[model samples]
Target: VWVRGALRFSKTPNGGEKLLAAASSHKCLIQLEDVAAESEREEVVARYFLKQGVQVIVYLGDITKQEADALVNAANEDLRHSGGVALALSKAAGPEVQRESSDLVRRDGKVATGDAVMTSGGKLKCKKLLHAVGPEKDKAGGRERELQVVQGDIIHEKTDVIVNSTGFKSEPAGVSKAILTAAGPPVQAELFNGQKHKFIYIHSGLLGCKEIVHVQTDQEAQATNKTCKKVLKLCESKGFTSAAFPAINTGTNFKKVEVDPNSVEYQDIAKGFHKTAKYKIHKIERVQNYHLWSGYFVMRRKMEMKNSAAELGEKYLYHGTSAESCHCIERDRFDRNYTGAHGASYGAGVYFAINASYSANSRYAKPDPAGLKRMYVARVLTGHHTLGDSSMKSPPQRGDDPSDKYDSLVDNLQSPSMYVIFHDDQAYPEYLITFI
Candidate 1:
């Protein structure tokens, strides 16, 4: 049995007061309304679990003022405690609560959705504060759409569509294999029997979903964004509202492999430098080959940058600097504060050169006491660039729209020899080479 509104003190013909008095003896779980303001008076809004021994009571009041042993705050994954109930709770609990939440994220990374991290309640009445990250609505999709992060098998999810990441032929591998196995033989037969396409939609035979979307994974990072947009468009066309997708290409798709000196990878890099080296070679020095790791944060920023740019136009470029600066760049990454160190001819940003000889000049690459010059072979994202001048600090607006801005600036649009990016993360130092 369920009850609504506050229990009255006056006796009723149905013996409601007797039932309410009996409920007072049992242990009750009090849940405060999330929308309630701090100044609101406490009142019983609803009740459940009448048949069971447990009593579930919903009260209209501020969660921070509750005398419960613990209080739960709806929080983001980062636990910034800057908005909504999180902000209110943080204010009531004191500064230590926010500080501890930040420290927790730094130590253990961001808390996953549907997971909760505990912290001291500080000045609050509760002894502990549980920061719970909940599923958020997909704002990009629509107000009616929600985005949830769930664990367990995707094949078991009951949705309109299930996305499977696979090769062109849809060979059974990784998540694709598991999905096909659960979907039964008909799905596999349709995938192999049909003409090869980038995306193939097939009927879900045994799987819980109504349909399956097989996406051919690409090596380029930009492909991820493109595939998502394509999938959403397809879903909209098909009138499908819900879909479940496995974490695509989050595994060994992109790995940092050390380029062996004898391997073709090393030779190709060496050839690039030698072909563009205007100065005559005196003596060849050491070339240390190390592939930069693309961690989670880096990949996330890359995707965002790719989506903003008209054309990703990624290229292998060179950056020359001192030995001390090289060490700092490797450890701390590129710093925009040091922009214009060589000269902001294009813009006040980190500059990269298509020709290694340009960066090899002493003006940019300072010689160490040992007489060796250092340079870096970096992966630069020269996206949707236009010719720039010293007056500009950032990329200019792409067109009439102020919100739309160019990703980077170039020396020349038709044939860009130099690229300047205001964003530090736009360029990653992949290989550092030392020479005479």
Candidate 2:
């Protein structure tokens, strides 16, 4: 991209207007015609004009102030709007921006690399001031050591080059050219290693009632870790090397536990799989913490319905008495705190179970630190077990009692030496699955 100048103007005789018009027309420079003002030239005044998509111009004696939609402040790691650019922005705007910035700082420990915070530009001409933290200024002593360690890792990882600059910088290393990009299905397949696994797609009642859809389930639901182990046995029987899984029956099936997709349940399962199986555990998720709970509440409205015999039976059997109601009858303390405490307990339970001792070789649940990761993975598989499947072909169905379901996957392993492949995603070479 380059800039091309058009024609220049004279220094006399109504030349300013003519030059301005000419400049606008040809995207040329507008200049004073002459020092000797002609009668028509006196009428020609330089009125302040701003145009869209036009380069700014300043006359020889004009003083210009930078006009921008907003100003950015370089804040400290603590997000304090203090000193240097921070002070400048604070003075321009009101103290409110600083206060908001401080609040945000308190909320998220230190601002990390490539992170930013926004605040209202109280009295400033700008609408907002975005606070950004640059890399740590102190790059000596310990900083150098840390940088060297990080640089060594990057180099060891076969990175081509490292670029450094103040302000804006660009690198020639195109992410698109990488051997594998951590996005879309290819990455997923690579992580999972073609592990034929199943997941229970459990939609919350709230999600089912919403006009705007929210939740989507995977394959099936397992009542406990036993179900997970059973599914792995099935996968092994089918000659699958590995599989990616989620907390099965626990999420939607188990009431009273608010199942966050990213809770400890998922984490424990991933870690367990990584620990026990010779496979990669690709945990695909996003951080949607508060939104899930809030959205659940917002979609809690009930719909009118005509009763059928089956519906009547369901109502009579499950919800006939207040004590036995299966549906979310009323917004109680449980619903209010489900997202935080209630959900957290369930997440913790799964985390504990996965982290607890287990013996995969013997297909038993014990407090074996060595087998915790495997147990967690087994738990995730349990989530995939379906109730309708026959026991002769499939592992036992998930029951309310978790102990019975424990280690079912290991017990049902078709071969003692079956291989486990940890694929990062599904698109990893299918040949890898065959190798397993």
Candidate 3:
């Protein structure tokens, strides 16, 4: 009907003024306080009449000040009243309103896009607050782009594609493991069994998303960049409008160089090899590497600076591989893609042994045609590790928190003979030992 704000009747209207005058007696008028006298005398902007004999009036002013029955709040899915109109409404309604809104989301889950939920307006003029989640920009084929860095769990994001970073085998680890855990076992099964492509797509089962794009990445800047590009391309090809990615390859990168034979470092490394190796060392060639050794030192220094309770847990370990793989390791550093080349009893990672004899097994150090066996003396970062199993694709969480994870995995925590490192940069090949 005829709700009054600052209503002004038109004098030039043909019969509009006469009809409004006739219905003026039946109009329901609401007097708003502190309005300018001139504003009260302004002409009506526009009006529409429905078939049910009701008149709609349009008014422009502060929405929070309006004494409407319900106020619609443009809110995120979680109903966080942080900015813009949502913040203003929440401020006007007081903190209790936000608590009520959060309680609603917690009880009924997030409000989906194009849908809404209602909460009682605490101190606001409106009686009820309608929290509505709107569609993201570019979702409906718009050209504009929007980027946001949100600090929270990625699994809670509602996007067309959720990226899961893994090794070449597409086995879940780190963030990928968390994603798979949330997505349920079926998604993990499909991830392993599905045909290999540039990227693997698994249905998001229990996850609050549409699909999961598992991309293989190693602890290298180049690999991270390549993974990002592939993910974008995959999303484009699949016609997905939105995707979520966690911090991929958040580890150091290393380069290998041949160490000078006359250097003192070389003699010390050779002496250590002579002390540890069970087999007779035919030769010990020191290699200059900046990743695992330097990375371990950096982590140790950082821990000391922060005065963290955990120790760095640095250990000199040995890894045995075939001649071809040895060359690859020397060239490009340890690649987690070949994680299970020998065995993955501890975990799917680059395995190292505290005892050289353990790694010197024929199964690991495959003999060449000339019967020469090769092993690497690597400085491994085994910071706060725990016992791991064959099923583990990554180190388990430190405690109940998923974000805080162990730096490495071991066969035994008390006396770890074997250490498994998921991140490639966590270990560096310092010396190459050739023995019969």
Q: Which one is best on TM-score?
A: 1
Supply the global lDDT for candidate 2.
0.31
C-alpha RMSD in Å of predicted model 3 compared with the true structure:
21.7
- State TM-scores per candidate: 0.39, 0.21, 0.38
lDDT of 1 by residue, 261-358 (tens): 54334555666788877543333232221112222124324545546434676688988888778656765566776535668888888899999999
Residue 346 of model 3 has an lDDT of 77
Residue-level lDDT tens digits of model 3 in 369-429: 9999988888776777788888998888877889778888888767777888887666767
After TM-score superposition, the amount by which residue 134's alpha carbon in candidate 1 deviates from its true location, in angstroms, is 50
**Clashes in each model (backbone N, CA, C under 3 Å)?**
0, 46, 0
Let me know the TM-score candidate 1 reaches against the reference structure. 0.39
Instruction: Report clash pairs, candidate 1.
Output: none
Give the Cα-based TM-score of candidate 3 against the true structure: 0.38
Query: Which parts of model 2 have CA positions greater than 4 angstroms off?
Result: 1-28, 31-65, 140-436
**If both were scored by lDDT, which would come out higher, candidate 1 or candidate 2?**
1
lDDT string for model 2 (1-436, tens) is 1122222334356755665776699986544343343222323234454666555444332111234565567777786555655666665565466556656765777787668877776777666667777776443323221112220111113221211110111211221111111122343243235332233221122222111111122243444445545545554465443333322222221123323333333443333333534533323222121222222222111111222223211110000111211122222211222112112211211111222222222222221234321121110112221122112222343568653332112222332211111111100100000001
| C-alpha lDDT (0 to 100) for residue 335 of candidate 1 | 74
